[model samples]
Target: MQLKLAGLEDIEDVLTLHRKYQIDTILEEDKKDGFVTTNFTREQLTKLIQEEQGLFIARHEEAVMAYVMAASWQYWSVWPIFARMIADLPKLTFAGHTLSTENSYQYGPVCVDKAYRGSGLLEAIFEFAREKMSHRYPVLVTFINQINTRSYRAHTQKLGLVVLAEFEFNNNHYLELAYDTSKSLSLHQSTHGQH
Candidate 1:
């Protein structure tokens, strides 16, 4: 698979993969299979792309296979859930590093094609994103639905993200996870053995 930061031209393929794995599109029986919590619009994506905000995609055979999105605090005004998350950021920390709106970026709603779910492609894509974004931000923060064990394991066990806080929103429980970018790069290298 080819991994790189997404461009405006990639918006359509990114939306395709985003829609395919979204929670609402999957049946209850398939919930255990995987789920994406957010659905981004073309306009929102276009803005992200135009501003050079983070959106990394992995493609194989010229088709999008997965994507990971990272956004700044400004996006909170566009998504209320993010606004809620922003309200709690002041209380969170990881590895002696405190998270602040200026130093951290919201990470997630990452989705991978079901066919490549366990193929180690997710980690590769995340590492690619970290390599690109870590220079601009020291911390990467994200929240995951408590029930999405697949994603929880991937974030905690595979990516070395730590759960720093937990809260409920609209009746759904979520765990806020943080990654110290500098340390994470070392962890990724050691755990994945140079990828």
Candidate 2:
């Protein structure tokens, strides 16, 4: 299978994958707690992709596998008004977020097709982004539910990431992981001639 940045052509697959996760599984503990309803629209994802604050996806001769989005990166802002608006939305899992966040680019809503669960693609997703994120964003932060052992393992064991802290909101625990690029990290090595 092949991997590449998703374009307009993959909109349908991307939307399908997003909806499948948001609607089918109890992705967010907030939903189970009765605080918000998880929801996403194709228009929103399409617009986000156009803005280039995240990475969209497509697979080799297959449906869109998944997507990975930077928490607050390029072309992004922390306007209080925008923050307030997002806080009040349905399925607002990231309830306690603020404009005065911290250093690093946080990652959100990483997902892969259910059919490809054991293929180590998730690790590759981090590798793909980690390849350049060291300099692009400097620090990459992601909040994975502490109970989600699979994600935690991949972030810590497979990718050699470090757990910085844990955050709690709406009774859900999220492990904040960071990619420290200060040392001789191979993640910073150039891959221009690889095939």
Candidate 3:
């Protein structure tokens, strides 16, 4: 598998993978395999890619196998839920580092194709993204649905992400996770290079 930051030319391929694992397309029993909470639009993705905000993809034989997105708090306008998430960021911290809109970026909506789910590609993609993003921001933050055990385990266990806080929004419970970029990378080195 090959991993790299996505360019505008790769937008369509990314969109295809996004749709394949989108929540609406997966069945309840199949959800354990994987699912995406958000469906980013072409326009939004175009802007993100152009600005180099964060959209990393892993590919095999030219097919997108997995994707991870990282964006600044300014993205809150694109998704209302993020506005609520941003409102609570000031109350959290990691390794003595406070998470503020200016110093941290939003990370999430990661989607890995089911075929590569257990092969460590997800961790590799995140590691690559963190390396690229950490240069610009010191913290990486994300939220996972309380019931998405598959994602929760991968983020907290496999990736070693720390839970900073949790809150309810629109009736759904979510766990806020933070990673002190510099420290998180060093601590997860063993697992980061797997596969």
Which of 1 and 2 is the better model by TM-score?
1
Task: Summarize candidate 2's per-residue lDDT along 71-159 as a digit string, tens digits.
Answer: 45433334332343233323222223221234355565577766676677766665665554545545555557776676676556656
TM-score between candidate 1 and the true structure: 0.92
Each candidate structure's count of clashing pairs = 0, 2, 0
The sequence of per-residue lDDT tens digits that candidate 3 reaches over residues 78-161 is 687899888887888776777788888899889998878888788789888988888989989999988888899888877888
- Please list the C-alpha lDDT of all candidates, in the order they appear: 0.83, 0.54, 0.83
- Which residue window of length 10 is worst by lDDT in model 1? 186-195
For model 3 the local lDDT of residue 4 reads: 83
Ranked by lDDT, the better of candidates 1 and 2 is 1
The alpha-carbon lDDT assigned to residue 126 of candidate 2 equals 57
| Ten residues in sequence with the least summed lDDT for candidate 2 | 91-100
lDDT of 2: 0.54
Q: What is the C-alpha RMSD of each candidate to the true structure, in Å?
A: 2.2, 8.4, 2.4
lDDT of 1 by residue, 43-149 (tens): 88988777856889998876899999887878644677888988887887766666678889888878888889789898888888887878888898999999898
**Candidate 2: stretches off by over 4 Å:** 23-39, 71-103, 181-195
Model 2, position 94, has a per-residue lDDT of 26
Lowest lDDT sum, 10 consecutive residues, model 3, at: 186-195
* Candidate 1 segments whose C-alpha is farther than 4 A from its true place: 184-195
